[model samples]
Target: MPDGLILPIANQKDYIRAALEAGKHVLSEKPVAKNLEEAHELITCDTETDWRKNPVHQGGFLLDGGVHYVAGLRRLLESQPSSKVCRLSSFTTLLQSHLPPVDTINAILKLESGVSGTYQQSVGTSLTGSEWTVGYEHGVVSVAGSKVVVTVAGNTEVNIIEDERTGVPPVVRIWAEAIAAGITVKDLEPEEALADLEVLELMLRSGESDGLSMSCQYQHIVSNPN
Candidate 1:
């Protein structure tokens, strides 16, 4: 039997449960599951297949791609102990005919620590820029394309990271290391992935409800060591 299982997004529930039952560690691609119910099943058990473009798959490419942004946003906010997202309101729409179901989302998120932020994602926009910015009490960090700029006290610092394979390699390395050491990495845990999915799913649900406020159920708050 293989020591670990790396699975694609399709039919993940069965595969993850089977692998876990076989005593193998598993790493599956994003979104975790199609919905919160399926995600919960996988937590008791648990990407992209061509079905990603099919409307039956729900949110189509939005769900396929949006999970990454949600995960990144969660990581950024969780830098503090009480920063987990507690609720959100969102609006979603399809900006391009080619991207079915929906291809854009704009959301307002409120964190457990009482901080708030905006999240916007679009796959079919004429706009030509990419950025993920997080503001802190003392500074702001903005990542755009290959550069990360940090502004603090009126001073700005920039760092260029030109890796095209950015997050994949590091996550794969961590998963491998965790497996080899027979331990779980907190970030790679199924629950963490589920939390990521929960945020996205609620956003989609909120979008479908015309931006009704949705509460998050799976956010995991990490305690600060200090």
Candidate 2:
């Protein structure tokens, strides 16, 4: 029997539940489920088996790809216990005719820590660049491609990460080591992944309701102090 399973997004809950019953640890790909309800089911029980164009895939590329951005944003914010996103309002639309349902999203997220930020993503845009920025009480940090810039007290510092690899490598390494050692990696926990999905899903839901504010239900409180 295999030790773990890396699953696709479609009908993921069934597959995950089956694998767990078979005594196999699972490392599923992002967008853990189609919506909040399905994701919740996985916590009590539990992809492609092209989320991109499939309406059945919920947010299409948004949920399939947007989860990563949500996760990254959370990490960059250094979210504390109960500091997860609590409410959000978003507007979603399609700029490209080819991308079905929607392709662009602009959202304002309010966290439990009383901090708020904006999120924007679009697969249909002609523009070709990506950046994540977080403002602190004394400084601001911004990441563009492999470069990270920090500004504080009228001073600025820039650092370029030479490696081009994304987070996949280290994530896989940790999963492998955890399986070998009979332990669980907190960062890889299903709840953590669920929180990522919840944020994205809430944004989509808010978009559907014409940017009505949506509250989050499954924001996980980080156990370890940062």
What TM-score does model 1 achieve against the real structure?
A: 0.84
Best by lDDT: 2
Error of 1 at 170 (Å): 2.6
Candidate 2: segments with Cα more than 4 A from true spot:
1-8, 46-55, 162-164, 222-226
> Model 1, 1-226: lDDT tens per residue?
3354554566677876676565555667888888778877876652222211221357878788888878877876777778999999999998898898889999999998888889898888877666798888899999887789999999999999877556777888888886677565688876787889888888888999999999987786342111
The numbered model that scores best in TM-score is: 2
Residue 25, candidate 1: alpha-carbon lDDT: 58
lDDT of all the models against the reference? 0.78, 0.79
- How much is 49 displaced in model 1, in angstroms? 26
lDDT of 2 by residue, 1-226 (tens): 4455555677778887677565555777887788878876776563221211121677779888889988888877654765678899999998888887889999999988787889999998887778998888899989998899999997999999886367777787898887787566677877788889988988888898999999987776443221
**Global lDDT of model 2:** 0.79
